[model samples]
Each structure stands twice: as structure tokens, then as C-alpha cells.
Target: MFGDDWLWMAVQWSPPYGERAGFDTSTTVMLLVTALVKAAFLWLILRAPLPGPLDRRARALRRLLYLAVAYALVLWYPIGLLPDAVDTASQLALWAAIDVLYLLVIRWRSRVLRAAAAALFAVELAGVADQLLDDLNLRQVHWGEVVGLGWMVGGAAATVLTVVGQWRDGRWSRGTLVAGWASLGVYALVITLNLLAGHLFSGGPAVSVIMDAAGLVTTVWLAATARELPTENSVPDLPPARLRAIRVAVATVTVLPIIAMIHPEQAARLTYTGWSTDCYDRPSFGDLKPAQRDAVFLCVARGMDGGGPPMFPESMSDQAILAYGRALCRAKDRDEQEAILTRAGSARPSWGVNPWDLVYVCPEIIGATHPELLRSAEETQAANDAYIAEENAKCRDPWPRTKGVVQATAKYFLFVDGDPGYLVHDPGDQAAEEEADKLYSGDGLVTVGRNSALVGHIEDVSDLCLTVKAFRTAPPRRTAGWQQVEEVPIVSRTGRLTVPEMGEDEVGAGAPMPNLAIKGKGRYRLRVYVRIDDGGEEQHLVVVFPGASRKKLTLKP
Candidate 1:
């Protein structure tokens, strides 16, 4: 009976190491109190007067010993001894047995039984004391009360039994019994107070006062009601085999549950990965549906160099209007593009166009011809540029366009147009207004119109024009205003050039302007200056050149 099964149960019932109370002063005091209580109870039982029969007393002593052993088992194994279900059942059984045993002792009317019960009660008191200490030290009051309360109740019952046994045996006078009863009452009060303090303060030094009072009262009551010693005699003993069997049964019933609680579960040891395609770990365009995928692909394709291929085949039916829009842009078939975009806008009324789509590719078509449709796009770009300028100005830095040659380089990058009208206009006959609305409504077409003139110019020349502007910096000497200094220009001759005619009206005061009429196929440079009066300060110049490419010059005083 005492086998691996019992050991497993014990292992299961043992308290988890993580939950164990750390050793501390409060724990030590609890242990000390428990030891003192046990010693006092033992002294009382040993000194108690002999009852009518030695056998009755022996039986009582045996019962108390059993209870003491049970308390020890509980303390050693706490919760981990068995499976959760089994441990719960075992706990119920143990409590039931204690109650039944108490009832039997009361019915037997034996002083010896009472003494034995008291001894067992003392053991339970010790167990509870240790539990209380653990709770105080570990700050686990909830668990402590759960495990320790039972033991405290058992101890109180045992104390009362001892007092009754002494009184019935005629070992004490009536006055002494009354006093003992009164002492028991005081002990109960003290225990109640200890419980209250424990609940109120939880794990604190304040509880020690109550525990001390309870312990003192219990000790004094036990001492005052001490019984005379009974003579020792030989009694019938169980066979060795029977004794072994009983021991095995007791261990199996009591120790197995605690052992079972400590082992880790099998499920905790395994890990899972990539259970399904929707799982994040599995990877693939998991979030996009087929339509959304096609939408994104077609949108990106329409915005590619020269408005490239259709992202999806012509045969695909769902969201066909978007596919039609892509075909229009791809074919550079303006009538078809307009027709498709219009259809898309009608189908999806919530769609809004984006003007930035036309800002670069078809700026003239969208901005100049259909200004209302693309105004927001232009304003957005201008706002973005202003924000960047404001941030750069914070460091006392001049705008890059006002510096030497940088603006020309920047414009060269910005205005490089290989196939300008490629994405500007739809190839279909749909109205520009409808197409623009669809684009804005997120029908996937970038609605900004392309400049036919700009695209023609780029194609004709095959080269980009660079316009350079120059400005003078502030002088070292104190002055009211700045004056313009000499201007220098640098040219990048790599592409073809076709300078547009510039009118005199475009020139501003003291601005070194470009004379487009004198233009040649190769890059050229020109210098201009601003005149200042009284030499008040070094003048700063502003220059504007006609073309997509413009550079700036900074003149230091």
C-alpha cells in the first residue's frame, strides 16, 4: 500500500516552491509560540489525575496522536500532493474524520480520551502557528488563513476537551473548574482577537500581540487544569503485519496528494508554430483580399514609368472599372481613360481624386486647364514645401534655392520629363470632371493633369534647362539693409536644351534675368547685379530664369 502511488500523491500535494514563505523573525516567533503551546498541553496531560479506566485513557491518547500526525502531514505536504480533484476530496475526508473523532471522544466520557484529544489539539495549534508564520513572512495571508484556520479550531476544541476531562475526573475542585472554564473563555476571546488582528493587518508585526495573548491564555489554562499521571501497563498489540498494513494505509491516504501537485504538466512543455495560413508566422499577403490586391497592383502600375502595363488581365471581372482605368492610362488613350474613370466614379461615388498625381506628369493639363480639380494637390505640395522651408529656417539657414547652383540641380531632378503626357489625361471620352472626381475618390487613378507643352519641350530637346539665381549675403559692417554682389553661374551640359521665350514683364527690380532669345543648344551662363545707394549695406539679389531647371548663387560680401 505504501508504494510509488503514495509517493506520487505526496509529491503532488507538496506546496509549490514559489509559494513557500521566506524565513524571518515572524516565522520564528510563530514556531516558538507553537512549541510553547505544545509543551504546556503535554504537561497538563501528563499531570492529569487517573480516570476510571486506563484503557479509555490509552484510547484517547491514541486518538490525539493520530490527530497530531495528521496535522504534521498537512504542514509537510500543503497543496501539491495529488491531482486537484483528488486533493479536494482528501481534504474533505480529513476534516470529516476529525469531526467524527471529536464526537466519539465526547461520547466515550473518558478523561484519558480528553487528554489525548488535547495533545492532538496542541499539535494542530503548532501546525497553525507555523502556517501563520509562513503567511506573515511570505505575505500570503489568504493562503495562510485557508490552511491554518482549521488547525486553530481543532486546537480550541482540544483545549475545551482537556478542561472537561479534568473536571469530570474529580481531579480539580469546583472553584478550580469554574476558574478553568473562565480561563478557557478568555483563551477563546484571545484567539478571536488574534484572528481579527490577523485578518485586519494581514502579514504584519501587529498580529504578534494577539498571538502572544492567545498563547499565554492557553498555556495558563492548560497548566492550571493539569491532571495526575496514570500508571503505565502493557496492552494488547497488533501483529507486525497488521501494524505495517495500517501504516501503509495511513501514508497512502494522507501523504499521496501533496506529492502529486508539484510535477509540471505535459502541455506546458510543448510549443506551437504556424498553425494556419492566417497565422502571422505563416506569412503571405494575409490581410489583402483578391479585389484589394488587384486594386493596389493596378494603382501602382498606373503610376509607374510612362504608365506601364495593366496590373491584372482584361478578363478579370470584379472591380472591372478600376482595371478599365489602368488600361486607359496604359494606352495613353485619353478618351478611353476618361470614359473608364467616369464609369468608376459612378460605380463608387465615395471615391475622391488626388491632384498630386497630375502635379508632375500633367501639371499643365490638371493645374492650368482644370485648375479646380487639381488645386488641392498643388496646395498640398506647396504646403509641404513651406513646412520644410520653415524647419530649415530655424537654424538661420538660407533657403537652398537661394544658394549657388543647388536650385538648378534640384529643378533638373524635379522637371525631368521623358513621357510627360503619358499619365496626365485619360484615353477615353469620359468628361474630365467625372474622371477627376473618380481619381479623388480613390478610384486608384492619380488625377493630376500632365502638361502637354512641357512634355513636348522635353521630347523635342531631349535635354533639361537649368535656371540659376544669385543673391548677396549680409555684410560684416552694421547696415540698414543688404546689397547685391556679383553673380556667377555654372552649367551642366549633359542633355538637350530648348529654351522657352521669356517676356520682359517677368523680370523684377535688380533681378539678374535670363534672355531666352539669345539661347543656344549648349548650356550658357550670365551675370547681373543690383545697385545700392549710400553704400548703406551689402545688397542681396533675387534672380529668376525661365525653365523647369533653376540654380541659385550666394554672394558673400
Candidate 2:
């Protein structure tokens, strides 16, 4: 089960619908191009002329040729889309099919070896068949799990015999090497090597394409260096008509897999996956009706295997929900938008996303809890600008602008900005509060004083902010802003951002935040706005340096 889960995790290299990591259209296009080249190369190898008629190996070569041809065509664009639910089962079937092919080429002389190979073949075939039916709503795929032990036992036995039998024959035949190399390709494709290698390689469609390239190259080797087998003393036979008939048989089956292309069945519509999300490039969800919108999104989400890791921090769940919510918010109007966001509240475990735009859908929640969003976007921006001006006048420092991956229908980039008081000097007070709300107390960011440890890994850094809890007093008023003082500057870059090297002593000297990595030696100062829960607002400027006075604020867990 962990193998399945890890393979699923390893294969998620594609960015969400709209990501800001500069992973753009060109990279995706190149991925598609690689797959096509692999498919074409495989087709060429599969269609290579069979061993000469005088060769006793011709029968086996012809069968392998036919099988490989069918497999390549199906494994390409159209037919390979079976087991079509677009989940783990579908992925398993694709990889399992390759295993079946590897088992096929093992020359079993003993009855025991043949039986083991046959058993492995039968179980995998049944598993793959049940998967297709499972997607069609005809049956569940429980039997595959039940038979998997027998499947592995049979597979291992076949592999051992194949190797030992080849060793007994003195030299390794080119055919045997080709089959072994292709089997290794199958192993590499399904993550057998990656798991042992500790996930050093990246995944997604590109990895699968690499495996197919291996298969094509191995097939070429198989054909060019085919082993010389026993032949009859009689002259080479097979008349012109018979040779033409064999060619026709190969060509006919080669083209038969195209039926899936002509009538791809429901998998084309039902199975939306990472490989095919942009295949048709459907218009915005706002362009569809209620029923159509849900249908499209559900299919696409299933395809992409959306949902949180089984046991993960709340931040992971929140991001998955945010990405999906951003996609769903593309509704035609306020009425449709309400239908989508309202699910977060009604759904069993709440989505836990901030009610930033929920004002349009659930204003009651905001009016009672998140009063910050009561203001409009323009009002929030103006307030941020005014505060930035004050800081500039007093400290002669420009407010730092942080960027984020913006969705196509996003109103503005700060979907949920963390506290501007953290590493990022974000000017927006409301955005800062919402972003901080997710991280301030979560495993992602928990700050302590100079004597304590840091929270979160380097992955916590985003374009807009590095979510962190500063070892300073919680702002008394509705808003506050913080930045490294002129002396102990936190970063090394001027315009572009870069992580600074933090030594043990320096880290213990200033802020207790994990990502601070303070760069300078001398002390520093920062301005803040604060108000008591029951009283009027006030302003204060605090200094920071080695052995500076630090206050640890309690954050919500």
C-alpha cells in the first residue's frame, strides 16, 4: 500500500492549474513532444521485419513483434487510457501491463517454470480486467489485492529461473539481454528503483516517456542482434503470398488499437488526469452551468487525485482546498459562487480556508469573526499604502512587495497573505493577518525567543512570504509591520530575494523565527501598531540585536 501511495506521490510533478514557479506552457508542450517521439520510435521497432524464414526463432520473434506492436499502440495517446477511473488502479494497470510483457519473453523449458509464468500472467490479467470493470461500475477490484501475493510469488520465481537458465547456457544471448534491459525499464518506470534510490528522480508524464524510450531501444537491440537458432536442413521457405499474408496480419493488428481513438468510450470524458487536464483546454468554470461546472471539476479533480495526504499538517489541506476553491470560484455570478464556497462550511470537516471572499457568500461569519475583510480591496490597499508612507517618513525604508501565484479569475494576488510582520514586509494589514492565521501557530511556523528553536523546513518559503512566527510581542492594535533593522539586515539580495546563511550564534542573537537567517552583526529597530483587546490604539518602535529583549507570543495551535 505504501508502494502505491509513494508512486502516486512521486508522480505529482505537474503544477496545479495555475502555479507561479515559471513552469509554463513550453515545458508542458515539450513533455507531450517527448511522449510522441517515444511512441513513434516504439512503432518503428515493433514493425521491424521478422527474423528470416530460415530461422527457427522466427515464430517467437513474430509473436513478440505482434505483442510489442499492440502494446506500444495501446500505450500511446488513445487506447492506453483504459482502467479509466483516473486513479491508482489505472496507473497500476499501465505498469502491470509492462510486467506482463516482460514475463512473456522468458523461455521456460521446465513445467514448473512455465506454470509459474502462466500464473503470474493470469493474475495480472485478471487484476487489470477487474480495474477496467471497476471504473465501469460493474464490480469492485478487491480480488486483485487478494491475489497479489500469488502474483508476486509467481513473478519472482519466473525471474529467478530466467536468469539461472541463461547462466546455465554459458553466454547471455542478445535476446536475453534485450528482455532483461526492457524489464529493468519497467522496474524503473513503476518506482521500484526510485523507492530504493530514495525518490531522487522526479516524476509525471516525462518519466513514463523515458521508460517507453528504453523499451524502443531495447526492441531495436533485440532485432539487430537476434540470436541464431536451429533451422531445418531444407531450404528457406514461405512463398510470396504467405509472406504478404503475415505482413498483412501484423499491419491489421497494429491499426486495430486505433479503434479506441475512433470511439474512446467514456474514459475520454470521465478520466481527467494530470496528463489530460489541458488536453481539450476547456474554458473557465464561469462559462459552465451549475451541473456542468460540478461535473467538469469533479472529473478533473479525480484525475489529478486531489485531497490531502492521509496524515498531514493543516497547511497541506488548506492549500489543496485553496487551489480547488480558486478553480471553483470561476462561477458565472454571486449565486453560483455561494453554492461553491458554502460547501466549505457544510462539508463534514470544514475546508478551513479563510472567509476572505466569503463575504459575498457568508458575510455573517466574517462580520462575527474576521472583521478585517469587511473592507473592500481598494480600501485595504489604501490603508496599506498609508502605513507604508508613515514607515518611510520615520525610517526611510520602502515597504517590501511580495508576489504570489495568481489564478486566472483571482481578484488580486494576496489570496491569503501571512503577517507582514513576519519575514515579508507586506504592506496589506488584512492580507497579512489571514496568511499569519494559517502559520502563526501551526507546525509551519511557531516562533520562540533567542533561547528556543525554529519551526518549519525551507519549503515554507513562498514568493510572497516566508510564513513565520516572530519572537516579539503580538501587535496590540489591528495591524503591525516588521523588518530587519539597518545593521542586521536579514537578506543578501537587493531586488531579487535569496536565503541568507544563518550561523548558530547569529540565529540566537535576533528573531527566533526559522527563516530569518539574520545577515548583519549589529542591532536593529522596527515600528509596530497595536491596540489592547479592550482599549485605544498605540504605536511603538522596538530595537533588536544580540541578546536583545525578546517576548514570546502564544499562537493558536
Candidate 3:
């Protein structure tokens, strides 16, 4: 007898549901119903009279009873009370036991039955291999459904051969063969359709209904076509003691190799993969209904390519981070957008931009608690600043305008650290408050600053302003405006003035600028705007260098 509380936990941990309360309840009910049906089948088989010796019928009856007991023990009882690791081992052991018994039955019959048994074993072995290799990648294994399909196919084939052999010996009736074949054909078609539609057992209620119908039909046909051997031709049956000994021997012989072959490390790896929320996470969009959850799980398992280590921070649960990141991308907030990309990093990056326009655009949209994005942004900004510094050093007079241009370009190109102020404000404010609160409380402010600052900020004042000015450049113009455009000190051979022009061209042929002066040493500022569009709606602030001389300067917006 099982306690109700233990029974609930047992149901919670078992196959087909795995700790989901509603699914556990439904599966519990299903197992109970299946157990009852199997019990009834055994009772009916026992009640049917034996045409040969009592001992032969008794042995057959015991075999059916043993199968029923095994089903009840494994599927209906508290076997899942074991730890998940142990439960999996137990389940495999149970399958081995059943397979051995089935093989034994075939061995007891004849050479033909032995050959059929070998074929069935081969199919089962192939199925197991399929489960381990192909189905692991597909993430679509349903052991119950797979076993059911095999049973329907294998049982039908065996029954057909038996009927044919009997008919050859003049021991079969037309009605029995017709009924068996008819039932098999219908069941096979239904199962085939179910599998094709990706329903199978995982479809829940609808597939359960089909399974019930198939079971009922098969049971009825088997009952109607039940036959017994003649007394004179009956094979000698084993006594209960001998049968039990054989059962023990067969169970040991069959189960030991499988048990030994089981790699705990491999099983642990697979168990973690299947149950961990990393590879499969809930959807952030649409209804959060059960169906949607299932769809998301299936989609993530099947849709995403390159199953590698997760990109999100380990502190955040894989499922939560993935869901939030996906939602953030959809919302398209610039900060959140950058955060997602930063979090994805070089290793995994994104599959591409989300097509759905759900737009989760705030930094807070990343589950608020996950600051991995912020941390990553800080690191990126520091790296970008260093790269820009290194690049600026290569330039002649790398200060003010040149330095600012390099910084701006670096920031835009790298696009990692986010807006400049993002890194400093949060920690700076927190530190200030902590110091103030400690001083006011007479606890003495705890000094917490390192020789090297954690935050990254621009060092040079001119570079800072220049970078700002570059960022504030007007929107792109429709066409080049000659009137508003300033003649550059350097010009192309075609008479067009190009800013920071690399090639040699005379100053007289180029366009010009106003308030243009090259500051001593490493600084320059030109207070002129060049209209680069016909609409004259947009312009560029042209900052010139020493060698640059102008023809004409114009300022326009």
C-alpha cells in the first residue's frame, strides 16, 4: 500500500510528465486505467478453458499474470519514488526484463518462433540505438509510444505467421485470421497517422483516446481468437519452482550486460541536458498558455542550431535569460538592443535580428536582476577606448579633432560599451550613498577605491567635446549643396573639396570653410558647415588641419 503523499511525489517524478502537477495527475489516472485493463485481460485469459493439460494452461496463465504484475510494478506503482538517476536505471532494467521474458516465450514455442524472436530483438536493439543517437538530437523520443508502435507491428507479424502456420496444419479458422488482420490493419493506420502528424503520445488527450481504442480492439481480437494445444501434443511445462529459477536466471543474464553498459557519466550528461532549462526555454511572446509553453519548448529544441554552451550569465537561469533576451530584442530599445548583442558576445552572437516587432527596449527589460550585460558593456567600452588610443597614436597630432574623430569612429564601430555614462553612474552613486550613510551613522565611511578605476571615461577634455560634436552631426543631406558647402584647404583633382583628404590637390581648386584655424601643436577647430545635400536640410561641421587652406567658407543648416 502507498501513502497518498508518496503517491503524489511518485507521480510527480515519473515519465511523460516529470514534476508538472497537472500532467502528473492526468498520467496517474491513465496508469491506473491501463493497469485495470491489463488486469482484466489476465483474468479473462485465465478464465478461458485449456484444451490440453491443466499444467500447460496454468503456465500460460502465470506468464500473462507475470506480465500484468510487471506492468503494474513499473508503470503504476511508486517506482519513480527513486531519485531521477536511479529511476532511469530502474526503467531500463524493467525493459530488459520484459524483453527477456518475451524472448523466452518465443524460445519455448519452436524454431520459427525462435527466428521471429531474433527479429523482434533486432528491431528493439535498433530502436534503442535510435533513441540514443538520432532521437537525442531530435529531442522527440516518446518511449511509451515507440514501444507501443513496436508492439503493434511485431505482435501483428507474429500473429499473422502463427495463423498461417496453423492454417497450413488445418488448425486455423477464416473468421479468426480476418478479425486479427483487420484489427491490426486499422491500429497500424491510426498509429502511422499519429506519428506522421507529430502527435503520438505527446499529443496528450487525443492520442490517449486513440491508444485506448487500439488497446481495446487488440484485447478483444486476442480474446476471440484464443486457442489451446491438444493434450497429446502439449509440451512439458516447468513447475512453479523451476519457472521462478529460470525467471531469475534469465533476468540476470539479460539485465547485467545492459546495466554494465550504462555509462553513469553519459546518463548524467543527458539527464542534465534534457531537464536543464538551457537549450529549451519558455517563450516570451504570445499567450503563456500550456500549449504555447509546449510549442516554445519544441521550437527551441528543434529550431535553434549550434547547440553549444549557453551565452547568458550563469547567475541568471538559462531559461529566464534567454526569454528576456529574446523579448528585449523584439522591443528594439537601443540600450536593450545593445545589451542583448553584448551579452551574446563574439562566441554565440545572434541568429539574426528578431522579425517579430514586440520591442522589449529597456535595460530593465533584461529581467532587471541580470547585470551581465552592464558588466560586459563596461569591459567592451574600456577595450574600445584602448583600441582608439592605440589607433590615435598612429595619426599625426592625435589630439582634439583627430583624437575625437578616432574615438567617435571607434565607439560607433565597436558599439560594445553602450552610451558613455552607463558604466559610472550606478556604482558611483551607490558608493557615494554608502559613504554618506556610514558617516552620518557614525560608523566611519568605508573607503573602497582601487588604484585603478573600474569605470572608463574619456581622459582628454578636447577629445570629449570633439566626440560629442561628431555625434551631433546633422542628418544626412539629399544632395551636395554648393552654396552652403565650405571649400577645403585640400581638394580632389576634380575640384571637389574632401575633408581630411589623403591625396595631393591644390587649395585654390577646393571649397572652403569659416572660423577655420589650426590651433598650435595638436588642436584644430573650423566653425564652418558643409551642406552635403540638395535639400540643404543636413550639413557636416568641417574641422581642418594645418596643411589645409580654403577657397571659400560657408555655414548653413
Candidate 4:
């Protein structure tokens, strides 16, 4: 009947408020007080001599209805009232109504009461299922989830026992009774573990677990007593005056808190006797329409002074806009500037006027007044773009590489300087010079120096044939398969450059080489295209021509 309030007690902490982390003292006090009231009320119903000659088990079951009304105030305040989520608030209302009905008639053997119990059980099962699935999907488990799972197990067990007893005319089968006792047994074990952990006093999580254990223990006791209730036809007879009193009591506890939850403003006046520090203290946008823009600015200034981030007002003075831009310019880094701008932009409606547009309109003034700032910003953007382009050319692109079957291993490299390994057989003095000719000689699909192309195959795949093609300018980009294109500047002193390898390399002293070379020792542009086919064979194509300056341009990191 208390629903997820038991689970909330298990996790005892409020949602973070800006920089404030931990439970709200007011909320904790409210929980403790309501719990005490529930205990006292239950004690009275069990021990005190009341007007009605109520069955002990039946009265225990009925008391849950009143307890539900009391706890709704405690649950609704933090979960829905504070957030102002209308849908969440509506859901809580629906849940409370169903729970109240279930508790009110759970002792009577009626189809309506059985249906209510089933519905309540369904809700609890659904919640537990969601939590279970969420935990399964999450990569890392948190301590809160562990505690929550423990609570779910206990709650589900109690719900199963209660709902089953209702369906079976308030009598538990032997097996069901065992399961109920087992669930309580587990709850006891968990309580023992919590005590052994030695944090039963102060910490939020520890205290909450102890509190939730107490709640579940109460539920188990109540559910156990409910099992002894007389069948549907044997319900205790109560006087009309007792019924009216019960109704009045439940309504008084339920309605007033609901009204408070609905209109928290009036509720605040009764309870909170302090100055309001909320955003509502400032004039709303509609109220500021007739007022000068200074009013909006001053309101925003006060909000910022309270350690809140700045926000864009509906209307901003040119001076204010300039000040914002200058502040961004003064930021230590681009990330900080973007963060400030993002917060300001997020505060305004999308269809409304943008603050940056106003600043951009007078770029000349910004550039002149903040010369070192704006001009450097442009340079910074250019550098950023250049860095992005350079990063895009990096060969370390991760797989899964654009949908293709791995047929043969093939990779291509562009050497601005001729292949470093061409004439370089390692270490010894005569070693490199002796093998230079054979290595440099245009052999099959391989070449040595002077833009000599050499293709190396994956280990034993040296005989694997690859197709090579070249374009005078540029080819239409390959839409399918993995591809990379980079514009490389070539400074050719002799003007002659070799085309990349296409076919297999025959390791022989003299092999007919392709007579593909651009004739010019001047500055030229080489656009290299490396592509991979579905069969995993690599294709290389270089567009060699005279274009772009040969001067080396170094990009900043």
C-alpha cells in the first residue's frame, strides 16, 4: 500500500540541485515524521478501544488504507511536487487511488477487491521488471542498484503473498506461506548484513537501508495477518457511524495533502516562513514587456549573483550584448566560451532573437575594440579546420570498415620522399649499395627510387594481383567500399614522376615497368586515392599533375 515509498526509503537521497549534492534535511524530517505517525496510528487501531467491534486482522488490513493516505503526502512531495511534472503527479494519484481501494476491500472476498489486488501486484511487478532490465543493460553496476534490487526482491515477494492470499479467499497455501516466510527471512538476513557493515547511524545510504528494512518488516507482518482474514461472506459487521468516521479520517488525510501538492504556492505560505529565493521573484517575460530592457538585465544580474549561470533575456541592450561577447573573448579557452554561449542560447526560446546575431551585426566595432580577440578567433577557427582535415587523413581509421568482404590483405602508402626502403638493405656498409640497383629497378609492379612505386603484399600473398588505374585530374569518388583521398604536394626537380603499382611484383633483375610518369621537375599536385574492394584487395591511383604551391605548410597541433 505504501508502493515505491519503501524503495525510496531504501535509497534516501534527493536529486542533486545545481551544485548541492545529498538529501534535503526537510524531506528527511518529513519522512521520519510521517513514518512515526503511521506507526502510532497502527498502534491505536490495534490496541485502543474504538467505537466498532472490528476483527483484529480486518482492522489491520483497513488501517493500510489510512496509512496509504498519509504516505501519499510524503511520496508525492519529493517525487512529483518539487519537479512540477504533471504526468508524474497524475500517475502518483492513480497509483494511490488503486492502492487505497485494494487495501480497503482486500479483507472482503469480492471480485472487485481481488481485481484491485491484481492490478496493484501488476504495477509492482512491472516496476521490478523495468529495474531488472535496466540493470542488465547497464555496463557498470552502482551501489544504489544493488540496494534497489534487494528492495525489489522483498517488495515483489510481499506483493505476491498479498495478491495470492486475496485470490485464494485470504488463505495462503502451504507453499505460498513458506515463500512469504522465506522472503521475510531474506529481509532479516539483509538487515543483519547492514548492521554488520557498521554504518547504521549517519550515512544516507546506510540509514535508508535500515529504514526500508523496517518498512518491509511492517509490510510482511501486515500481509501475514491479512492471510487470517475471514472469507468474503464472513466480513466483520461495522456500524454506520464507524464507517463514516473511517471515511472522514481517510478523506481528511488524503484530500488536504493532495490540494497542497496541486497548488504548492499556498502550501508554501503555511509551512515555509522564509524569504523566497526562487526565479519567480523576478518579473516574468510577460510582466517585463511594459518595462525597460534594464529590468530584464537587472533580474538576470541578480540570478547570476546567486551563483547561477547567465541567461539571455528576451530583449538585450546593445551594451549588454557587447559585454557578453567581450566576456566570451576573455574566456581562458574555446571550450569555456562555447559552454557560456550554449547556456545563454539554451535559456531562450528557439524562435526568439539570438544574442550572437546582435553582436555579429557590428563586427567592425568588435574587431576594432577587441582587435587581438576577434582576429585571433578567426585564425583559431582556421587552425581548427586545418587540424580536422589533417586528422581525417590519418591512416588509423578503425573497423568495421565500410561493408566489404575480406578477400586479400592490401594497404597503400604515399611517400612524399621515395620509398625509404628502396635502396636500403640494412646495417653493413656494402649491403645497401649492392642491393640498390635490384631494389630501385622497375621490376614488375614494383619500383625503387625517383617516385618509384613498390607494393608489398601481406606475408605469403606476394603473388596476389591488384588492378591499378590513374586519372589525369580526378575520378568520381567511389561510393562503395573503403576509400581515402589526400592531396599531396610534390616538388619534382626532374619533373618526371612514376605512377603507383597495380599488378603483382615479379622478383627479377629486369622486368618491363609501366612508362607512366609526369614530365616536369616543377611544383605539382598529386592527389592519391587508396581504395579497398569487397574481396579485400587494395587499389591505388595517383593523379599526377602541375597544380598548387610546393611550399610546405605546417599545421599546428
Q: Residue 341's C-alpha lDDT in candidate 3?
A: 49
Candidate 3 whole-model C-alpha lDDT, 0 to 1: 0.37
Per residue, candidate 4 scores C-alpha lDDT tens digits across 426-527 of 112243334445554443232333222233322223222222222344344443443454444544444344423323231211112232224334555544
User: Each prediction's TM-score against the native?
Assistant: 0.21, 0.28, 0.31, 0.25
Clash count, predicted structure 4: 5
Whole-model Cα lDDT of every candidate shown, in order: 0.37, 0.37, 0.37, 0.41
**4 Cα displacement, candidate 1 (Å):** 34
Cα lDDT tens digits for candidate 1, 1-557: 45433322333333223333343554344444444444443444344443544456445544544444344334435554544544444444554454344444333366577567756655564564454445445443454665566766666666566567655555444433543555556556566555444223335332442343333333343333322223342223457787677457534432332232222332111111112222222122224343333333333323223444333233333335343433443434445555555554432222323333322233344455555433344564566456444532332212342454322211111223332211122222134324433433221111222210111111222222233342232222222233333323223232212222222322111112232212322233323232332522112222322233233333423
TM-score of 4: 0.25
Task: Name the runs in model 2 displaced over 4 angstroms.
Answer: 1-51, 54-61, 73-75, 80-109, 132-136, 140-172, 175-178, 193-206, 214-557
Indicate the worst ten consecutive residues by lDDT in candidate 3: 444-453
Give the winner by TM-score: 3
Cα distance off (Å), candidate 3, residue 38: 9.9
Q: What's the true lDDT of residue 365 in model 3? A: 43
Which parts of model 4 are misplaced by more than 4 Å? 1-36, 44-164, 167-235, 251-521, 524-557
lDDT of 3 by residue, 1-557 (tens): 65434543343323343333343555455545444444544454444533654355435643553444444434544654654545444434544554454444322346776576557655655455544444235564556876857755775565555445444444334433444565566556565646543411233333443344345434444443333323334324457686677457534533342243333431221121223233344334332433333333334423334656344333343344445545554544556655664664523445333322222223344434444333333464566456655643432221243332212211111113332211101122344334333322221111112100111122211121111122122223222433342222221222111222111321110112111222322222223332223432222233333334333333332
TM-score of model 1 vs. true structure: 0.21
Which of the two, 1 or 2, has more TM-score?
2
lDDT of 4 at 436: 44
